[model samples]
Target: MAFNYEQYLRPGKLPHIWCPGCGHGIVLKGLLRAMDACHLDKDRTAVVSGIGCASRLPGYVDFNTLHTAHGRAAAFATGIKLARPEMTVLVVGGDGDGVAIGGNHFIHACRRNIDMTYVLCNNYIYGMTGGQFSPCTPMGDKASTTPYGNPDPTFDIAKLAIGAGATFVARTTAFHATQIDKLIAEGIRHKGMSVIEVLDDCPTAFGRRNKFRSVVEMMKRFKETAVPAATAAKMSAEELQGKIVTGILHREERPEYCEQYQQVIDRARGA
Candidate 1:
């Protein structure tokens, strides 16, 4: 049977703002499927996003949604988790919004081991904001601001999440459409901070400037370059260059932030 995505989507919100061939819609469907698999009550789930092309996702979903300032999605979601720890809070945004501007908030949230899910949609370049180069852009990619080729180093978001103490971390590309929902559903079920990075394509902004002829070409690259985590482990470091290791990269048990905060309250009452 076909999944009834319409039940989770807002009526009259069709015709999203993403450009033709954009993969954000694919990721959105995966998210909705994950929510359904988890049996999450729409009223109890809060979806938050910052300013960016990916951040506009919450506007189309039927849930408690927050369209916040640029690069502040993690921070805003943290507050929501602290105030109502029982509610399922999810943060969604692009690479630039999550790491460049919201880097501090993102790291702290991970460090605290907050019980929330962060879905980072990485399209390499700043797709909406003038095709600017972002932290995740390839070292030598072309963008509006990097016509001469980007010189900055790229960030490994999954590695960053693991190092910063996220209890659950996973990565999947848009090409692996089926895996997106599975990873997201696992993240939602996890007890601590969960970061799922989705490598999607922005054909209009990132692809054209980088010389990708079409969306299919971009997706082909993902299919060729992605390595499953199990297979990646047996490969040599040299063999793994330029390869993205998808699947759950890291996961560990930890004390969730809200639960720890409640301990403080209990202690204070006893004092």
Candidate 2:
């Protein structure tokens, strides 16, 4: 609230549609704060999102915003960054939109090392269509689709980003507001592909079904489970299980996709 993020928000979209106690708003604010902190030019920034409760954030921000097709936000952002390499492109999407149907695109984007920042809102359930289990949903978690419980192993998106060759990767929960802002800012500043996997809460859809009594309880759980990378290094794997390791998990300097393409163009023109 102290931050002047409101200035970057679209006044016409005064009222948002997210359910009460949902953590998407917190993630949105962190992104805006990061944008302001990084001194990014709003006019030169493009905010891309896909279909979902969390994806609606782009509609509220005053930028070159694109609310693209379901599970295709990253693909759309890829095209934007390729065309306007000078512009700062940021992507916002839910777990379902980013890693479920769009998982392949997400993987390739990281592998390509395109210059962009992606804030993947992982609420562990599909909050838009229904409270169904998502790719990040923990095992034994019950949902509308998984009445008995989710039997599939959950994905740690940070590891996926690292394995896929993303140059920057980090994770922070919505409750860690200040930390998330810093991570987002760093992700924006990184030259290659960066992904900040935000452990956001969907109180209305996921919390109600996952034994979370209230939003406060859900946020408190994140604080209880989160361990910084430095601290996690000392803990045993058994002790670290079920804990959310929050911070910059991976970073490596790599040739960015757009810049690499420009080299080819420069060579072709000379020839």
Best by lDDT: 1
Over the stretch 1-271, how does candidate 1's per-residue lDDT look in tens digits? 9999999999999889999999999999999999999999998999999999999999999999999999999999999999999999999999999999999999999999999999999999788877999999998999899889999999999999999999999999999999999999999999999999999999999999888999999999999999999999999999999999999999999999999999999999995
lDDT of 2 by residue, 12-52 (tens): 79678899899988998899889999998988999999989
Determine which window of 10 residues in candidate 2 has minimal summed lDDT.
Answer: 1-10
Taking all chains together, the TM-score of candidate 2 against the true structure is 0.98
Worst 10-residue stretch by lDDT in candidate 1? 124-133
- Candidate 1 lands at a TM-score of 0.99
lDDT of 1 at 79: 95
Per-residue lDDT for 189 in model 1? 99
Task: Identify the leading candidate in terms of TM-score.
Answer: 1
Name the regions of candidate 2 deviating beyond 4 angstroms: none
Candidate 2 whole-model C-alpha lDDT, 0 to 1: 0.93
